[model samples]
Target chain A: MTVEVDVTIKPKRGVADPEGENTKKALHLLGFRNVRSVKSMKTFRIELELDAETTGDAEEEAVTSAVEEMCEKLLSNPVIHDYEILIVGRQIGN
Target chain B: MTVEVDVTIKPKRGVADPEGENTKKALHLLGFRNVRSVKSMKTFRIELELDAETTGDAEEEAVTSAVEEMCEKLLSNPVIHDYEILIVGRQIGN
Candidate 1:
């Protein structure tokens, strides 16, 4: 089975987001005065090849755990960013 | 009234994703061998200020149109990326 996950990462509250700030400035320059703020986030759509026998609840749990581990290990900086993991779908892989 | 929208931008199908590729390599090196592929995307959560009286359908439509314009102008590169807009919520701003 192949499980697909989307991990969204965003700067923690009170943390500086220069990219977002820059974008807000650009929008203001472009005459989008109604724009109040912009928060930029990074999302990773990851496909994982899992054991064929794992299905249903087990598959969902397994993918969630693995993806969380990936986020803790590399995808997110816990000190500055918060991450959310969402299991999108599963497909049988040959 | 304030409308919050999330704009997700991703590389068009078949386009190269070096950041995602690098992340995959790093994950593989970190022993996440099950990772088949990773596609990275950018999301912008934009808050827009609108007339206090505009609510319901008119508000929703106005926000959507303004956000689409933003995506077309700066949030996304039309040639290599595809974009999606999601209206998240509305709030009364004092």
Candidate 2:
């Protein structure tokens, strides 16, 4: 089974978000005075090939475990970023 | 009325996504052989202050117009990227 995982990683509140700040400033310049603020986050869609038979609780566990491992090891830097893991759906490989 | 907008920007198909590539390579090194691929995108949460009385169609028009202007002017570069604009909700200034 190929599971699609969406990892939304964002800078924690109070952390510097230069990209967001720049975007807000640019919007203001463009006459979007109503644009009060902006925040930017990165979303990574990971296509993981899990065991076809891992079903029910086991399947969910396998997916989360793999997704968490990826997040901890590479997708997210624990110090300044926080991430949310979402199982989008199963994908059929072409 | 303060409306929240989410601008999802992604590199167009056939365009290079170095960040996604790097993440995939990192995952492979970590033994996620089943991780077939990865795609990444940036989501911008723009908080805009609209007219409290601009309700219904007029309100929607104001929001989209401002959001679209921002996207064309800064949030997304049309040549290499494609973006989806979504109206999240309204927020109260606190």
lDDT of 2 by residue, B18-69 (tens): 9999899989988988888899999998888876778779988988887777
Q: Per-model C-alpha lDDT, please? A: 0.92, 0.85
Q: What is the TM-score of each candidate against the true structure?
A: 0.89, 0.86
lDDT of 1 by residue, A1-94 (tens): 8888989999999999999999999999999999999999999999999999998889888888898899999999999999888888778865
Model 1 steric clash total: 0
Model 2 spans with C-alpha error above 4 angstroms? A55-58, A92-94, B54-61, B92-94
lDDT of 1 at B36: 93
lDDT of 1 by residue, B19-81 (tens): 999999999999999999999999999999999988889988888899889989988999999
RMSDs, each prediction? 1.9, 2.4
Best by TM-score: 1
